[model samples]
Target: MIKQVRVVLFLVMLFTSIVLLSSQTSAAAGAISWTKPVERETKQAIKGGTHKKQEFAFGDGDLYWIHQVTAGQNQQPYVVTIPVKGESATFRYRAVAANKQPYWAQVSLRDVRVLPAASGFLETENKSVWLGKPIVYAALGKGTIDEKLTLAPPVEVKKTAGGYVLQVRLPMRAGLISEMWALESAEPLVIWGKESLEQIWLTLDVTDQAKWLYDGYYYKSPSTYVPYTETSYWRIPENYVLRSFLYTGGSKAALDMGYVMLKASLKQQEQQGYWKSLPRSQWLQNDYGISEGFYDTRFNTGAAGMMLKGCALYQEGEFCDAAKRYTLFFQQHAVSNHYVVEGTRPGWLVADYATVGKKSNTHVSLNHQLAEINYLYSSYLQFGDPTDKDLADIMLGGIVNLGSRWIVSSGDLHYAYFPNGTFGRTDYPYLTYNDLVETQRLYKLLHGMEEPTIGKLMASKLAWMEKNKVAYLTIK
Candidate 1:
């Protein structure tokens, strides 16, 4: 009898301790929780569509709506879009009611890592596409791996007139590289966190380069995505085996970094034999018997060319040379004379204007590629080697001369495309983040030159795309 009583008492004490610990843990850390999925919908009715609040591991302090925007029969626009804060790795919470019902909650990035302090926004000329503010990645010097993993301080935002200021002081982690990296945004958002801090996981590649290259955008390790860096701006092909996004959401600076990797690849080509095109990694097509590729594919021509043109504006000798090669190289990537790009993933392919509808019925990012290459080719001609004007003209002409029908206009608000060309009512969406600055700069640069009336008119359209953000931006 006494033994039974003792066992019961012990169990009671253990239960009390567990309850106390649970209560204390809940009291600490401002975490979010939701039981049931909250009912939500988009403000617009689409061409006729609905949006649902899909809880996901978006970026820090972020939420998303996973929707199937059906424009017509047999066509479904299944998209997972994040908030104005853009993309962030986040833990999602959903409750049918407030905190009253049984909820579903996840733990990942709280999305607190996104957004910028007004002072730290993309500090660049016109806040161009794919620009990187100078960031120094410091590796873990002499600490145990455990010591490097510590919590960082908080990130805060303050509002003023138009926009508010964001303040962030994030920690760096160390792993394979000596240094890690950060991102540059079209807005003033700053990202620094405990996991990516230099004191944590940092490493240098085989050539002694810093590990930041592998520390890509969404913290997707180089082992996953083709190119490591800010993958947040774009996504890998669903066919790819990547389980995580190296970088989440749209980041212009990350695009620029990808460009740098390409230039470096060109320089390294003469020195190394493995990467004839892909710099730090390899470009492998299951169709070809090329050397098996590496996990990092950031230096592909399409991505690289975009970065190269942006760099050509300033980095003269080496930058210009690399940008030129990248421009021509992009020509090699098209399918059947169209500018649609191909690489590790088919979805990553960017096609020439009007190609998406005329070529096939599949939903691909053809316009996205057109918008990217149009600016890149134009930028190279205007800023870099003037000798490459003929080459630029050829490609730029291809992008613009897709069809003769009147398309929607490129406004400061959104991208416009040909509505009457029989592609249905598809409108050219605005290229926010990196795409905007690149297009605008390229347009203005081209506008300054003597081109055909159509080209000049096109340049005017891009200018509107550049300035349209004024209405949406708080301008802090």
Candidate 2:
């Protein structure tokens, strides 16, 4: 009986040892093959750094990395580059700190674009695999991964003790091309050995080979409420539209604009002197995964400013009260960060969740700042409020600090300054015109004098416009 019991115990111990060995070997191998698709585009904050850039692709597609280099508060232009598929790239993501703190090296994905990541426009080959149909395998540290595919392609991620291995096999197919770049981390981790990693990336295979595609996991672009064809142009920057009407549209048009303005004023009054921006169409949020129901500062402040102008012109009590109330919100809520007046929505193009009672970083806008400065100065003049003067000075000082960056050699103002102090494109000539007009208005409000430099620049642009037969009407 004792011998039989010992034999049973020995067999049980052997089986246990075998199972334990197998489990340890599997963990050591670090071979985690996920059969289902990890379908979601998300922004995750990293522990080492704040910003991250991660890119992943399935199958043998033309892979590239899109990197956003953020050096301190100065936001640089996104650097898009084509990286060799299955190669390792180093990222030195900087932990941007004030007081000169130590930065760390980490890998991350900056912006999260959906799976079967698209290739660049210049690349002729189609590299992105079918959406929601990728086989993803995520491994922690080091090991050799061999993925054999039967009907679909193989996506492998091998992070060895010494180095890394990423390989994607593509099935033969036609019309499988991509015209967009995926997430990328610039190699060498450091540009000039000083810039820190704003982001980094690694390849992962998380596709469910069993199911072709799940219904809930797929994402499609949002359909436009207002569609635009090749020749279509949405009349954005409505300030320009209003100015255009003021310039070319006759008395009837002016009266029509006045009615529109009155309607807007009524709406503002209805909402306690605050503009209620429209929520993004349901399809937009549901389909495109974009933020909806955001308010624009430009519209809010601009409407209030226009109402103030109306009050000054017609001596209307309601207009004056609305203007004062709207402008007063800024005094209470606007955050002064060095020279930048943050927390206030500055432009129509600058959208924020403030409409939905949420806060976002104050986006800088040169044109909006100009308008706000003019409004604030006017407010100070009309109401004799020192707060208005202080606010105007802070915004004006920030703009003046931009100097040549915002003002071209011809003195034509650039369209805007991004929140990171980067100069946005100067595509809108009307923006410069508006800036000139606002500068003149602000100067007049401040010192009862026209800004001569701005006047000269406006004249310069106007003459060129006339010579070239620009469609915009003259503003004197």
- List the candidates' TM-scores in order: 0.31, 0.40
* Weakest lDDT window of 10 consecutive positions for candidate 1: 237-246
Deviation of model 2 at 209, angstroms:
49
Q: What TM value does model 2 have?
A: 0.40
Best by lDDT: 2
Per-residue lDDT over 399-473 for candidate 1, one digit per residue giving the tens place of the 0 to 100 score: 345423323444322222222223323333232323333443455566674334234434444556456542222
Alpha-carbon error at 321 in model 2, in Å? 1.2
Residue 127 accuracy (lDDT) in model 2: 20
Model 2: per-residue Cα lDDT over 193-260, one tens digit each: 32211111101111211111111011111233223222211111113223222222222222233323
Q: Which candidate tops TM-score? A: 2
